[model samples]
Each structure stands twice: as structure tokens, then as C-alpha cells.
Target: MDKKKPKKVFVQGAIPPEKIANSIANHQSKTNIGAHSIFLGQIRADEIDGKIVTAIDYSAYEEMAEKVFHEIRESAFSKFDMTCCHIYHSLGKVKTGEICLFVFTSSAHRKVAIEACNYLVEEIKAKVPVFGKEIFEDRTHQWKVNK
Candidate 1:
């Protein structure tokens, strides 16, 4: 096993396309990994009940969110032989069809990369304190991931 330092976790106000692409590029340079898996989560304008979602407002308990994100990074390292990992999530309002979360993972083999990416994403969603509001086209709103 190589003594590789973990990548930083970015919980930001908004993340642009370049940042996501750059993160993947950054991780690629460090790993001799043959496989890299990336997951980008974008908002969708979907009708919930009768309201069509027009935008998303993301809010987080920042201190806890960062704490959880770091835990995820460490967990990913412990669970997989991954070469590197990067995670970024938006913190403010993101319009319809905009990306809100990005997860990148790389490994020496394809299987580990894929599994680690999925696991990391799932853990973040399940444990993180980030909240999102779904704003409808009619100007009404509802919280996302309310469950």
C-alpha cells in the first residue's frame, strides 16, 4: 500500500464545470489506476405532486457537513484500495438541471473504482447534513430529501 495523502473535501457555495473536470484531472495524475469513476448529480425539473421544480436551494450545517465529508473520505480509503478520491457539493441555490454534487474515485482496477464511487456517494447522501429546497415554477417550495 502506498502512503498517499487524501484529497481535500470541498463543500462550496457553487461548483462550476471546470472544477469538476479539474478534480478528475488532478486525481488522474496521482494514481497509476486504470479506472476512474465519476458521478455528477444534477437537479431535474420534475413535478412533485402538482408543482414543477424550478430551482434548488441548498443549506447545510457547515461544521457538521465538513466533519461528515471528512469521515467519508477516510471510510473510502479504509474500505477500498482506491488510489485517490475527490468530493464536492454545492451549498447555495442551484437552478434546474445544474450539478449539485460531484464524486470522483480512482483505483488500480475497474471494479474497485466503481464500487468505491458508489459507496462514497451513498454514504454522503445518507449521512451528511446538507439540505435542499425544491422551488416550484409556481413560486412555492418544498424541502428535498425530506425522508
Candidate 2:
């Protein structure tokens, strides 16, 4: 992985399970990495005020969000002894039980991978300029707030 180059982080819709599997498989030849930590953020069927959420339509200022994602990756690399890191988030509608975000961190040790993965997830949620509209089963929608 090129540590200095910015990576593409956005996917058009829900992240595919095959992509996640391929990522892990591709890393098998990197003998130096002894551990990997992964985080998958799935949309939930949340109930609020008698309405049930069916999906989330995510949107973002792509250019700005990519910049922030690069900064977060750089920060993680500086703080953790990680060998590789990857982050992908959905750009369109993702239904309940579908993955909207995927974060993977690899390191020589389990703790570093785990900690870096956690850091990346938290930073992305707090710093990225992404927005989501929660779509209810009745077709009503409301802006989502990251909690």
C-alpha cells in the first residue's frame, strides 16, 4: 500500500460481501501482517415515533469527504503500527441489515489492528461530511443524526 497516496473510499451502494472477502484474501501474501480487525456498519430497522426505518439514503460532498478520509487514514498511520488500512462507505441507499461502511486495519499485532480500526470508525463518524436520510416503511423520511 502506498502510504502517501489518497485512497478511494466511497462505493455507490451497499458494500458487497465479496469485496470484503477479496480484501482479506488479497492480504494473505503479506506475511508481516499477523492480525486484522474489521468493522462493518449495518443499517438498522430503527423504530421511532411509530415509524420503522427501512433504509438510509446516504449522500456526501464527495471531494470534501475524500479529503477528510485521507486525513483520518494519515492520522491512524501515524498513531498505530498498522501495515494496511482500508475504508469504504456507501454513497446511495442501503437497506436495513445491509452494510453501509467497512473498515479494515492490519498490523503485526492484534491490539494495534483493533485500536486503529476503532479509531478510524470513530473519526469517520465524527469528522466526515456525510449525511443520511432515514427512510421509513411508510415512505416518510427524516435526516439521520450520527450517535
Candidate 3:
């Protein structure tokens, strides 16, 4: 039996807008898909304790993260009637307003695609072992925690 290989989720830096557009464009050939949902995670310039965040530096245990990502994909496939799914997350530094993560899902209907897209993003955030360092304007940094 043939199986689809797991895709590499980590990118070197910020996910470009063009990449996201290209992904959508590439799916136009699939005639069965009627809906597509996309989620984009962008770094915010947040202020805390008199410091302002300028960027976010991300890192992860690649082996473990890849395994978790695969698991998430499998779970989504089993849970939803999804036609396709794609996830891309950035490593290294992503400046404020830059995209750090992208999740795309397609299905025959709108609800399935939207829910699957949301599920993928939530699972990636809650399950993946990715860490972020919030870099401040003063060149100082602190670890980020998801709320």
C-alpha cells in the first residue's frame, strides 16, 4: 500500500505571504474541494513590564516535534472529512507583523474545513514542543508561554 509521507513543518524563518498564496493556488486543480480554511499566526509587538517585544525567536526539538505533527495530521484525518491539510511553522526569528505559522485545510464543505483548520492550529500550539523567545527592543528576551 502507498502512504503519503509526512511533510516537514518547520521553515527557516517567517512564512511568506507568497508561500500561502501559492499553496492556495496549487489546490485549485482539485475539483472535489469546495471550501478552504486558512490560519495565519503573526508575531505581535506586545508590551510588558516597560519592555516592548520586537520579534520572536522560535526553536524546537525537531525529531519530537515532527512526530507530534504527524500525529496531529493523522488525528485530523481520522476525525474530519478533510480533503487536504498543510501546516508550516517558522523557526529562528520572526519580526513583529511577520507570519510565524500557517495552517490550511480543505474539505467538501465549509464547516469541516474551518473546524479542521482550527483543530490543527490548536493541536500544534498545545501539543508541539516548540518554544519561543520574545525579543525586546532593548535586546533582552524572555521565554513565551501560550495562554
Candidate 4:
């Protein structure tokens, strides 16, 4: 097996929808893969105490976050019998309805790709050192909680 080096996961801001499509297009030449699974995390306009959220400003302990992301990638590679995987996350202000995270996995069949995609999402949520500050419509903000 040809194991590749770890890739940088953080983007300056929100991930673009075109990036997602281009990623899939990039893999079209790899004929050995028959299935691909993707997971996209979008910011939500949540209501709290009558304030409506407008966007989220994400922050991370960059060094630690990158290290953790590498670890998660390694773990997924080891655990899943898959062809490839890619992960990208936002590092700055991402408005509601914008994409923040994107994970893509490919395999010879549907099961491995789907399972690996799910695994990566769960691991990223539980293990990454990323934080989000919810910005409300009136410019008020608060820390976000994953639930």
C-alpha cells in the first residue's frame, strides 16, 4: 500500500461548494473506485434567547488542531479499507447556509466509503480542537456547543 503524507486541513474561511464538486471530478480518473461518500457540515441560523445567529467565527489552536487532524486521518486510513479520503474545514467567519467542513472518501464498494465518511465526521467532531463563536444578528456572540 502506498500511504501518502498528511495533508493540511484548515482553510482560511468557509469551504466553497465548487471545491466539493472539483474534488469529485478529480477522482473520476481513478477507475478502480466504484463508490464515493461525502459529508458536508453547514452553519445553521440558530435562535437563542430571541437572537438569530448570522454567522460563526471559528477558531482553533492551529498547531494542536493540525496534529489532531493528522492523527484522525491516519486512524481512518488504518481502520478503513478504502482508496482515498479528504477533509477540509473552515478557520474563520462562515455565514449561515455556508459550508464549513467537507469530507470525501472513496472505495471499491459503497459500504467502506460510507462507513469511512461517517467515521471521519465523528472523529473530527470529537477529536478536533476547533471552536466556533456564534455571531448573532445584532452582533452579539457566544460560544457554540455541539449537540
Off by over 4 Å in 3: 1-3
Candidate 1 vs 4: which has more TM-score: 4
Write candidate 1's Cα lDDT for 35-130 as tens digits: 998999888898899889988889987777887888888888999998878888888888887888899888899999999999998899899898
lDDT of 3 by residue, 2-34 (tens): 156788999999999999999999999999999
TM for every model, in the order presented, reads 0.88, 0.97, 0.97, 0.96
Across 1-147, the per-residue lDDT of candidate 4 in tens digits comes to 335666899998889989999999999999999999999999999899999999999999988998888889889889998898999999999999999999999999999999999999999999898999999999989999987
Please identify which of the two predictions, 2 or 3, would achieve the higher lDDT against the true structure. Answer: 2
Model 2, 1-147: lDDT tens digits are: 236878999999899999999999999999999999999999999999999999999999999999999999999999999999999999999999999999999999999999999999999999999999999999999999999
Q: TM-score: which candidate is best?
A: 2
lDDT of prediction 4:
0.93
Candidate 1 residues lying further than 4 Å off, grouped into runs, are: 1-14
Q: Give candidate 2 regions above 4 Å deviation.
A: 1-3
Residue 2 of model 3, lDDT score: 19
Ranking by lDDT: 2, 3, 4, 1
